[model samples]
Target: MTASHAPFIAACTELLGASHVLTHDHDTEPFLVDWRKRYRGNACAVLLPADTAEVAAVVGLAHEHGVAIVPQGGNTGLAGGATPDESGAQAVLSLRRLNRIRGIDPHNNTITVEAGVVLAEVQSRAESAQRLFALSLAAEGSCTIGGNLSTNAGGTGVLRYGNTRELCLGLEVVTPQGDIWDGLRGLRKDNTGYDLRDLYIGAEGTLGIITAAVMKLHPAPVARVTALAGLASPHAALDFLAMAQRHAGALLTGFELMSDFSMRLVGRHFPQLRYPFGEPHAQTVLLELSDSESDEHARALFERLMEQAMEEGIVEDAVVAESLAQSQAFWDLREHIPLAQAEEGLNIKHDIAVPISSIGRFIEETDAIIARATPGARMVTFGHLGDGNLHYNVQAPEGVDQKQFLEAFQTPINALVYDQVHAHRGSISAEHGLGQLKVDEAMHYKSAVEVRLMQSIKAALDPENRMNPGKVVRWAQAGTRKENIA
Candidate 1:
């Protein structure tokens, strides 16, 4: 440890036992890097606080020392939001020890969980209670609820259950100044003052540490229908989605659009997983119909929609999973696309979102630009079509060097795609927060007034620039506090 931060480490060890204070470089190395391994950082120590009170004490200590605090959970965030900076002047606050389910109220349809609880555990608890917590992602197995809430994560079910922000009812937070804001109420309505709970939800811990939350739950779906439909293009996929909505309405829980390239990568890298179709189509959409009705009803609805889509030529061929295992198999293909991509090589991923009405145009125009600029670069596009979130990613050409392709064109490719998204009045980041990855990207796309307002709020809540500094919004100085957060 540095001589300058020796006192800081001693204080942290005194607050929480020496066992919980990770000071050695090897012990703190794992917490310094991100899940994608794209960002590596350094930290003086990692503080593992077991409860809200301990977290409060640690935050107060950091504030007193003027040392930066980076709150980390499972560290599964793609945007580097939870990773510390490389200055080694910061303390990584790990919240994994606080994993607990405080309570579950079946009648109120709410589950109060500690921030360190894994998301899958919350879903399993809801299932045990015969209810559902619908915030799901590929990283749910390890990603903590605190990380999910902090990023306001959106997954396939966002079309139906809404993002983490909508799923959240209340939050227990520890501010940068070490004050605890106990807003953990299960009430559905509370308009007494400003929506403080929301301000912290997607703040990426730049504002405060989310220690616990009261999340909403829904009745478990009695029946679910999973299907894969082949489409001519993204336009046809959009049409097929509208047709399913016309037929199934709210039962259309998930609608994911995947290019044939995505499936091919999965099929090639993962030999055990195969494409269900006899032949590959340029475009395909995974249809999931779920409801509280009978299995027969849901399956029939899925079949009816597929038949009509084929008749209208929106879908060429389709397969409706007849059994529960088959449905899981269909989902496994969609969930493992990223894994297959990782097996192949590195690629630039753009998590952009546009209006459903503009999805087709965004795809065609963006692809054309990419094709013209970087010929033969494969477009591996797919995502939650129901919410207009597209994982528009580009793989290096078969013959071109991956590093050369990315280093040469990653910036231009991002600009082309983001320009298309902006033309449609869409977002540069759909589910993932800006973190350090897209702070400048967000500022470029967002309006001046919008950017200024965000900076003002960041300045107001964290005047000293102590909490997760250099994230979300760039700060001015320690004393340059804005007067209004609103």
Candidate 2:
């Protein structure tokens, strides 16, 4: 470490015990890298604070020293938002030590928790109280509440419970200047002024650190039924979606679309999970219904929907889970796509969203263009069809070197896909925030006015730009502006 940075390090070691201040490379390596291992940053030190007060103190110390602080929770972020830059000058403030479920108000239907609490733990706690906290995701076992809010994570439950932003009611954030803003109100409606809570959530720590949150909970569903439908094409899947929605309404909780190629990838990697269909179809959909009444009610609804779908020839074949174990098995097929993709090789990944009505056309046109440009390219397309979000990923051509394929086609392929998304009036990013990966691309697609407004907000809240620099919105002059965040 440099002599100039010694004082800052010593101060942090003093504020948080030396045991909590990790400076050695071996001790700090895990916090420096992201879950995907795509981003590896450097930090002068990794600080772990035990509570909100300790966090505030650590942030204050960093602010006084003019050291950049990257707030991280669980280090499970896919977009590299929680990782520091390569400068080795920033300090990583890890929030994993702050885990605590403060209280569960069963009557109010709200649960207050520290940001470090894992997503699955929240669900379990809510369930224990005869309530449901429904921000479900693949990383729920490890990802923290703070990370979910920062990325505004969306999972299968988004169709009914909405995204993390919709499920959250309040947040306690530590701002760039080391001041705590306790806006943690559990009220369903609070329209007094500007929403400061929202400013921190989904900001990716660019503005401030989210320490805790008050999340909304719902009554536990009496029964949840899952089904897999084999369809001829994306058009047929869309028709099934419309029909299912008409029949189930809000009870339709999860709807996912998986391309035939995607299913094949799963089958190739995980041979044990048998494909539910007799023959391969062009597209397949996984449907879920959460009935508040009973299993019989859910079964009746599914029977009518499946009967009509088969009679109309919308679905070639379908299978509904008869038990909970079978339902989980159906979900396992959908969730294993990402893992299978990793097993195949390095590929281009896109978390995008288009109008629900326009998804089939978008996929058809974009897939054709990708195929023509890069002949033999395999498409692994699947995601939350109910909410119009697709994990539209591109795989290397069979028999080609995966690394070489990504090196040559990642940029051009991304451009092609994004252009089509823009044409369809869709978003380049659906759930994952634009970390360092998509920052420049987001700028290219966003209008000048929108960019300026975002920059203005960044400048206003974190004028110094010491809070997670080089993320979301980039400021030409960072760490200089001294405007009050208030």
Candidate 3:
């Protein structure tokens, strides 16, 4: 290690014992690599702070040493938001040691938890208390609440309960200057000023390190129903989704759309799962309903909607879950899509969102463009249709070298997809934050004034640019600070 980094490591190890501070290359390897194994990094050390106080201390030490700090959670983010760079100058500040649920207020319908707590653990804790923490994701078992909050994660439940930003009530953060900002409150009606908590919500650690959060909760649904329906096209899926929403209203918790290619990959990768339908339909819509009333009523309502959709030619065929186990099995198929795609082959994935009314058109036009641009390329599109987000992916033709295909078509494919999204007034990124993965792409879509405003905010908050530099916002233009405030 360099002479300058020696003191920083010593201070981190002193504040959090040697066991908590990982300096050995082998120990810090996992934190340096992203989940997709696409980007690898090098860190001077890895600091595991046990609590908010320890986090503050670590931040203070890093600030004193003028060393950059990269905050990381469970590291399950699709974007390279949590992965450190290969500078070997930054210290990875891991929040895993702060995994603790502080309090659960049933009367107020809220729960306070440290940022390091896993998403699934929070859900389980809420379930234990007869309440529901509704942020559901495929990586719930590993992704931490901090990372979710940082990226403003959206998943299946967003149709009913909204995204991570909607679920969050408050956050406790350690600023770049080493001061703790205690904004943790469970109040639902705090109409104070600019809502500062939101600034760091999707900042991806560029603004500060999130230590804990107070999240909203809801009463557990007493009844639930799930259904799988086959449709002729994306337009049909949209039509069915609208019909289901009109019937089920707020009880409609999920509306996922999958293409025929997506189902084929799932069936091929996961043979244990039995297809709900006998024939391959062009599109599939997975719907879920939840209510405090009778589950039979919910099931019947779904069935009637499907029947009406079929009569209207919006639905080709449908299968309602007959039992609770069947409902879970259907959901299992939807949640395992990413894994199945991985097993199939290397692919280029885009997590994008458009207007609900424009999604059908977007898919139709984009598919045609993709086919024309790269003949024989397979398109696997699926995601929370209710939220207007789709995981549109592209797979190379059979017998083609994956690397060569990506090299030849990745840029053109992205141009075609993003152009449509931009034309339709859609966001380049739906749920995932603008990490290093989309730093340049975001610039293409965002205006210079908008980018400048974001950079101004970053400079105002973190003048030194020592917190996750070169992340969501470009920090290269942030000139050197004249003074140290802290």
Report clash pairs, candidate 3: none
Model 3: which ten-residue window has the lowest total lDDT? 477-486
478 Cα displacement, candidate 2 (Å)? 10
- lDDT of each prediction vs. the true structure? 0.90, 0.91, 0.89
Please identify which of the two predictions, 1 or 3, would achieve the higher lDDT against the true structure.
Answer: 1
Instruction: Please provide, for model 1 over 1-486, each residue's C-alpha lDDT reduced to its tens digit, 9 standing for 90 to 100.
Output: 578888878999999999999988789989999998989999989999999999999999898887899999999999999898888999999999999999999999999999999999999999999999999899999999999999999998998889999999999999989999999999898989999999999999999999999999999999988999888899998888889999998888899999999999999998788789999999888989887989999877877887888888889999988898999989999998999999889899999889998999889988999999899999999999989999999999997889988999999989988888899999989898889998877877777677777877888888888999888876753322231111
Candidate 3 clash figure, as a count: 0
- What's the CA error at residue 351 for candidate 1, in Å? 0.5
Q: Give the clashing pairs for model 1.
A: none
True-vs-predicted CA distance for residue 486, candidate 3, Å: 31
Residue 229, candidate 2: Cα error in Å is 0.4
User: lDDT per residue, candidate 2, 1-486, as tens digits?
Assistant: 456778888998888899999999999999999889999999999999999998888888888889999989888878888898898999999999889999999999999999999999999999999999989999999999999999899998999999999999999999888899998899988989998887777889999999999999999999999999999999999999999999999999999999999999999999988888879999999999999999999999999999999999999999999888899989999999999999999999999999999999999999999999899999999999989999999999999999999999999999999999999999999999888778777777877667777888888888888899988876754322221110
Give the 10-residue window scoring lowest on summed lDDT in candidate 2. 477-486
At residue 288, give the lDDT of candidate 2. 94
lDDT for residue 185 in candidate 2, whole number 0-100: 95
**lDDT for 152 (candidate 3):** 96
